[model samples]
Target: METRYNLKSPAVKRLMKEAAELKDPTDHYHAQPLEDNLFEWHFTVRGPPDSDFDGGVYHGRIVLPPEYPMKPPSIILLTANGRFEVGKKICLSISGHHPETWQPSWSIRTALLAIIGFMPTKGEGAIGSLDYTPEERRALAKKSQDFYCEGCGSLMKEALLPVTSGSASSQADKEAKELARQISFKAEVNSSRKSVAEPADLSGFNHLPSSPEHQQESTTLAFQDTTPNEVSENQTNSASSSQEQHNQPASNNTSMSPRQRRAQQRRVPTSTNFNQVQQPRVNTNHMGSNALILLLVLALAALIFRRIYLANEYIFEL
Candidate 1:
């Protein structure tokens, strides 16, 4: 059994570099690759302050492919955020479900920003997306801080510190620009090598050029005040409710009323499956045309036979 993947590969190295450089510029979100696997990462996202997700810290998992930066990752929320289904792959233009839309230059930072912003918007009939009410989202958001993943070995709030002092986008924007610059440089190098028909040796290619000062800043986030006591107390009951709702299979919905079931079904987008519609139309047309031709042939044969019989009878009488 082969258990090793090329962790030293160009794609893997780039991801590792990005992971090290992942600083919470906005302090609203914190993410890092797992200790055991560089391809697997977990992140905590802070809800927008004015939206229903305000004051909420949501936890989720990101599974990057071995060919990452080219292929998008699969993202699943572990926390029971009302906007998305727990432990399910979210359907977003940036997620693995839509690789065609994924740009090789896009990093984890861009995806995180998209997720935070998309949380409060309509579900758009995407998988793992939901249209819960604002009040429901607020309730879930309040409880999200308490939810923990054993894999990360830390509570959502304990691991990621909230930004209390500085401006939100200052640090984040700087990190993003630096990442984009690195990506562009790498792309240019790859294109140049390809044009000359040279075998590219990217083992020594360290585009971002890791800095000691940048490494120190990763651990410098300040913690904000915790959620209210009331929010924590209600979490005990809401925890079970959220878990039950999250774990419950979609197929076991006999308990749901007709209206409720229809509502749930409607959340799933109808596929543009041409086979379901076009096959039936073609079959009906083909059958109708064939039957009409057969009927016409039979009628013509009968008329000819009747005329021949009448002519024979008249000849016999003469």
Candidate 2:
């Protein structure tokens, strides 16, 4: 293997095996890179039938913890319109919320299966999944299968579950799928642990296997920094995008109507430029001179305006 799997790490080994399950490749369940980066992975799953996601293949991302089985993975559904925010963390027992509840014995496949099983549910307090009525869920679920992701720029597809439209889905099938998902995620966790430190520069990067071995050190670094830090290529790209907008000089929109002006202001995105290069400061004497000149000009203008106004008023009164 190009990237060594943590052998002493059983979690990594389990994840390695899970990578093999993707072999049954069909339309329903697919995992792919987020844009050009391999570190981030997206998945498309079929929602359980008789529930809202019955005919849908929801698309979402699986964020591996810097620490695998040691820590649960966080998921965010991008295409499933039934409540969860795009790219928001989907908290389950196997997610970040109940880290203590996650079992190393559990694999990525098992977790994914569990997610499918939960689809028919109302997810009252789930971090990502939403609670909606059958009607609303039906409306969104239909869209889930074909939903395209802007960030991924790809449509997520799912293999329809084989059982009859409303067969008694076995817990075993779900367990198997969850196990596979867990295995894939475990590889990422183990790998990340070995690659600790910030996510190294990706300029020379090619492929990062979703092997359980990789730990999410960069993710941890991102979360740890009270300031949003760009450790990965994606983060840097997003940060740069935001900074570019912020630094852009205001265009000549002064003639725009009030509504358009307010819309323009709201449209301007704000992002904390945590990695801006330093700029040189001007001397204090120059600043002071500029301030004094500006103040004198303002005083003169005010006095002239006041005298003109008084003269006009007196004439009008006469």
Using lDDT as the measure, the top candidate is: 1
lDDT of 2 by residue, 237-312 (tens): 7676776577455546466554454455445432222122112233558877687667656666765685576567
TM-score of each: 0.52, 0.46
Q: Evaluate all candidate structures by whole-model CA lDDT and list the values in order.
A: 0.69, 0.58
Top-TM-score candidate index: 1
Tens digits of lDDT, candidate 1, 1-318 = 434557779787878778877844336677888877778898887776568887788888999987888899999999887888999999876789877567887888777766776776678688999888889999998898888789987586675666564665455534444543443465456556655642222222233227775334322211113355654655554575565467458638588655555455444323212222334333557778787667656666765685576567657756
